[model samples]
Target: MKVAIVHDELVRRGGAEQVVLDMHKAYPEADIFTLCYNKDKTYEEFKKARIFTSWFQYLGKSEKLIKILYFPFAILAMRMFNLKGYDVVLISTTHCGKFVRVDKNASVITYCHTPFRLAWRPFSYAIVNSSNMIIRNIFLFASRVLRVFDSMAAKASDFYLTNSKEVKARIEDSYHPEQPVSIINPAAKLDNFYISNEVKDYHLVVSRLEDYKMVDLVVKAFNQTPEKKLVIVGTGSMEAELKALAGDNITFLKAQSAAQLAKLYANCKALIFPQHEDYGITPLEAAASGRPVIAFGKGGVTETMVPYNGDSARCTSVFFEEQTVESLSAAIEKAEMLQFSPGFIRNHANLFSASNFIAKLKTFVSRIYNLKTDTDFYMSLTEKVVYARKEVA
Candidate 1:
């Protein structure tokens, strides 16, 4: 069957974009469609696929310009997709890819990373960190407009799948989808990450330098403790702002390949996940490398990481309840004291391996394709009978 994979954009590499790459692995022949494409910014593996970009790609290649226009342009660009011949259109999206149009006979299955957080939870996003009241108010108004479109897109999709319970709840609250939202947690490629013989002194942070990600919080926390070292590996819109806030204790690295990142994870004392993610992949990656995580105890991290509760042997991470410098710093101190088993940590991460993810996704697609085939058969049979009756009369 002809298949198509859709993603919101290809400008950056994050958890959502990684999901798109995994989707491609599941359906190698499926053509990839996106709002825009930037070969330099995203994963290099996408070069193997037949990629089609919307009109937005023609506008500009600037990351800031894309970020500014993404919400408004994405909705319109999604509708402009001509996926008429594809039997299945699988969307891996956090935002507007769900609005993609296809023939009535085609099945549109959305693997929603989360509801549009910017639109649905504007107060918790970049605007919350902004000092300008005028910009905040305009953003709030724009959120309302985006929400209307987001809800419409949610209702149009035939099936819904998500990466975590946290995101499923958000999707339900935001769109109130009639169908059950299946939860398929994303995976960490255990093969790509390996345990190192020597654990380094520095803590690691692997995430996009975005406002919602709260990378700045980690930088500020590390700054307060100058003795402790931090190595942040990733870049985004907030790179400059974050760097300005960081102290000499904090070092920034551009995003790395899987092999390079694995080496970083294997050597680090522990991964620092400051953001409240939908379904965090970096924590799993850290775990796969036999490294523990010191993360804010909320969102998908709570589900993925085995938090320390007077049991260092069983725990793969130390959790801090509040998203504050003090809480994270305390957690970091606690993690330093704990003696965790590398074998146990790696075993825990094995539960969310790339093989498991690929198998589950392949099964999901097969089931959906079978149901669509049955529906088409019944529809064609009904149409044939109706024509016979018309001729008889």
Candidate 2:
């Protein structure tokens, strides 16, 4: 099949990129496409894959801002792109991926991470911590425009898929009530984290320091636990302010390589996921390396993490009730008692192997490719207008 996979950007290797990578593996012959061809520092380190970029980059930040300001520009751009002769179009999206304006006959399935919170979430929240009113209002107005485009994109897609059930619920409520949606979780490679004999006595939080992510909450909880050490391994707007609050035991580092991060996940006492994430891949990465995750009891973690109960101890990670320092402190203390076996943790991670994800993904794509567009497809297309017209006549 001549598959065309759409993505938001090519920069910053994260969970979403891993999903795209898996699609690349499943459809090796597929021509990858995206809005921007981000100059990744480690693109060559990955296996060979054929990828393409839109000429939208030529418009520079002005077009980017326009696209961001008026989401229809993005939708129109997707419509304008000549995707003729492609059998399948898989949109691996966080924000902009759903805008694949192609022929209705083409099978398109979107793997939505979430509705863009900047667009969907309230504007009052955006202005909560911002100082400049003018910039914030501009952002707020743009976000409304973004919402309209997002809705249009969702309606345009053939089928909907979310990375988590949490997101699936959001899509139904926000985008379309009648849309068919499924949950196919994005996971990490357990084998990537090796069984290291050396133990490093520190807690790890490997995430961008975003406001919703609440990396600062982890810092606060760790500060309360002076005996425990924290090694934060990603950077964002909160970097300078967060670094200023770091104690002697907290080490703040920017983004690191896969090898370096795997080492950290393997050695840490536990991975602290203080935020309510959409679908946390880092927790699995840490568990795959024989470490338990300590997180707030909500979001995707609820789906993946079972309790470490009785003899089935290794099958789970620990959770806290609230996103407060007190709740996190108590969870940390409780986690100290839980049994963490490298073998058990590794076994738990096996359920989320890359092979399983790829297998299911291939099956889903095969169905779309084999679907009969002539008889059933034409009949359905006519049902929307032609059949109604005949009935009216």
Candidate 3:
């Protein structure tokens, strides 16, 4: 079957882009489409795929500019592309994933990370830190318009998929309550685990230094620890701020190769995920390296992090509630108290392996599409109910 995967911008690889990559692996024959494709700086692995781009790709050189330019480009490109030829239209979205207008006969399924924060989380750090006032204001003023378009896009879909149960609830509460929504948490490519042969003394944190990412909180929490050192990976605008705030213990790293990161993850005493993530791929990496994750108790962590119950179900990680120095300090202290068997971490991490995600996705697709089955009657009934041919394509 010919499938088409769409996203807003393919500038830098983060969690959202990984979803596209996995979708590509799932549907090798599918065409990968996006408003902008920053090919020159794209991850080497995606170089071979049939990446189709819109005119805005020329503006993809700078991600700061690309984020501002992608909205209209993505929305306008719906009129520019003929998506009717594809059998499955899977939209891996965070922002403009639901912007496209599909043919009435095409089956569109959107895996929404969340609605654009400008609409849902206007006060969140990710939205308030916009570079341009004009564009941000224009987007804010036209938020209703954007919401209508997003809703229409969702309404036009045959089904909806969410990365977490939290996200699923939000979709039901905010948009597409009538649509069939399913939960498919994002999977991790566990092979990328960076387990240094020789252990490092410092703790490691790999995240964009955004206010929402709460690297500031991590810094504050670690500042009080005094004993453990910190090595922060990834750079952002707040680098200078974080650097100045750091004491003798915290170290800032611009970036590192996958192998280097894996080594760091393996060697660190534990990975500190201060921020509440949507569906964190980093914690999985740390656990894959036989390390524990100390994170804030919010967002998707509740679903993924298994708290220690007993010998049979030991937690891969622990969570802290108050995003303050004291709370994280307590969690870190608790991490020291527990003994994590390397085998237990690897076993839990296996559940979210990329290969497992592919198998599960294929099964879901078969089940949703009502592909030939032994229970012909039930299959026929769902085929009629799910394939809203006249409603969405």
The lDDT leader among the candidates is 1
Clashing pairs in 1: none
lDDT of 2 by residue, 8-35 (tens): 6665567888888887877888887776
* Model 1, residue 107: C-alpha shift (Å): 1.7
Q: Candidates' TM-scores?
A: 0.88, 0.88, 0.88
Q: List per-candidate RMSD values in Å.
A: 5.2, 4.1, 3.7
lDDT of 3: 0.74
Q: Report the poorest 10 consecutive residues by lDDT, candidate 2.
A: 384-393
Question: What is the per-residue lDDT of model 1 for residues 265-350, given as tens digits with 9 covering 90 to 100?
Answer: 99999999988877788999999999999988888988888999898888899999888988988999989999998899999999
Q: Candidate 3's residue-wise lDDT over 148-178, tens digit each?
A: 6566555555667878887887788767445
The alpha-carbon deviation from the true structure for residue 278 of candidate 3, after best TM-score superposition, in angstroms, is 1.6
lDDT of 2: 0.74
After TM-score superposition, the amount by which residue 36's alpha carbon in candidate 3 deviates from its true location, in angstroms, is 1.0
